[model samples]
Target: MSNTVKIQRPKIPQDIKPLDFCPNEENLFELCIIRDCSIINEDIHRIRFEQVIFKNVIFKDVSFKNIELTDVIFDHCDLSNTDFRNGSIHRVEFIDSKILGLNLSDASLGNVFFQSCNANLISFGYSKLKQVLFDSCSLRNADYYESTFTKVAFKECDINEASFERTPLKGIDLRSCTFDRINVSINDLAGCEVTSNQAIGFARLLGLIIK
Candidate 1:
């Protein structure tokens, strides 16, 4: 059994059509690429996207509540303050995206990768994540209250002041991540892998006076 954390990639077709217009009245979008477009002030529910690639798209005041995305790749997109609560995301990759203040509470993410993204102030409350990797992302002040994580990894991420209260870090490695202060209980930090410097900080946080 291999202990490596390998996330699945998006399975998009070789031939895809470009979406020129804004998504409206469309419940299910498949086999399409929405690039260089802006979706603003649109309130949509249960919108399903399959095999879609969103590149350089900017979203403002868009609410995709209970959305379902599969095999999706979001590259160089700006999804700041977008609401994606209760969404189901699988095999998705968010690369070089600005997701500041993005609300993903209660979302189910599987095999998802977030790389080089500005994900500060993101929320994952009550969400379930599996095989998720957040690499080189700014996750300052992010919330993960009561979230369930399995096979999740954070590499080279800025997680200062991130709240992981009630979220277990068992088997999760944070050696490559940098954080000044994070809200996490000692019990939740059990079995979590960290660097020596981080361990010293944790000891200080526990009020332990080390010689």
Candidate 2:
């Protein structure tokens, strides 16, 4: 286990700035209030984001590697092909965002809230998540293999073809969600809780003869 944590350095604080362009190489963005910005192809590495609000921003192909996001709020942002690998997220909220092909593998999330986000093909493989809420999100082809989801709730999310294979889910709940193409064996769905409609959809896709 690599415990080499990266600490965010304190810089001069200011109000939210509108950035049109971003860095092409690896850089550290600390305590910068970047709102309504669009950063493309930036390698954001080992930085700390505090009290920052990235509202209506578009981060295309950005890599958040080994970073820490604390007290940050990403509202109505578009994060496509962004890699959040090996990062620590705390007290962050993602509201009404579109996250496609985002890699959250081997990361740690605590006190996070994802509300009404379009998260497609998100890889949460081998990650540790706690006190997270996914409300009304479309998580198609999301991978949760070998991840620990503690007190995580998918409320009104459409998780079609989401893979939860080999994940230890003991006390997780799925509320008002659709799971049509979930890649799981019949034994994997045992000891899990779901609504009647979800069960029917799972059975129909698996060709199970439900009497």
Candidate 3:
């Protein structure tokens, strides 16, 4: 019998199409499909999206403050430096995306899945994440200060130099990931799983001399 952990895949909606124009405050989107669009440096605020699907979209430096997204899926997108501060995201999946330096501070995410994404330097400070999965992602220098995580899994991810101050990571399995110089307190790392070599590195961080 195999005891390997399986990551959950995104449940994408079948009906979707290409979107041309950018969303506005007046015309809010609902149950729509947006694809192959570039919304660089656009400020999108107070918009509500329900069951929306975004595919092959590039959202460089886009501001998404206070947005409400439910059952949204982003596939093959580049969301570098996008601001999602204080947003509410539920059942959202980001697949094969470049979310480098993405700001998700003070946001609330539920049932979110990030797969095969380059999410280096991403910030999740003061956020609440529930049932979130990060698979095959690069999360170097990512910040999770004062955040709450429940049922979150980090599979085959690189979390080097990541900060987890005041975040309780009990029972979290980090053996499959690569991490070095991680900023985490001893209490925060309680019950977290690590490899033998990683335990040595963590011991070194605790001023232990392993001769």
- Who wins the lDDT comparison? 1
Tens-place lDDT digits, model 2, residues 18-57: 5434443434344455677678777767766766677788
For model 1, the superposed segments whose C-alpha errors exceed 4 Å read 1-4, 24-26
TM-score to native of every candidate shown: 0.96, 0.81, 0.91
Candidate 1 local lDDT, 1-211, one digit each (tens) = 1134799999999899998745667788899999988988988899999999999999999999999999999999999999999999999999999999999999999999999999999999999999999989999999999999999989889999999999999998888889988999999999999889899999997899999
- Residues 25-100, model 3: lDDT tens digits: 5747766788888877778777777777888989876787998878788889888889989999888888999999
Among all windows of 10 consecutive residues in model 3, the one with the lowest summed lDDT is 1-10
Q: Which of candidates 1 and 3 reaches a greater lDDT? A: 1
What lDDT is reached at residue 124 by model 2? Answer: 89
Candidate 1, clashing residue pairs?
A: none
- Please give the CA lDDT of all the candidate structures: 0.93, 0.75, 0.84
What's model 1's TM-score?
Answer: 0.96
Evaluate model 1: give its lDDT: 0.93
Better of 1 and 2 by lDDT: 1
Better of 2 and 3 by TM-score: 3
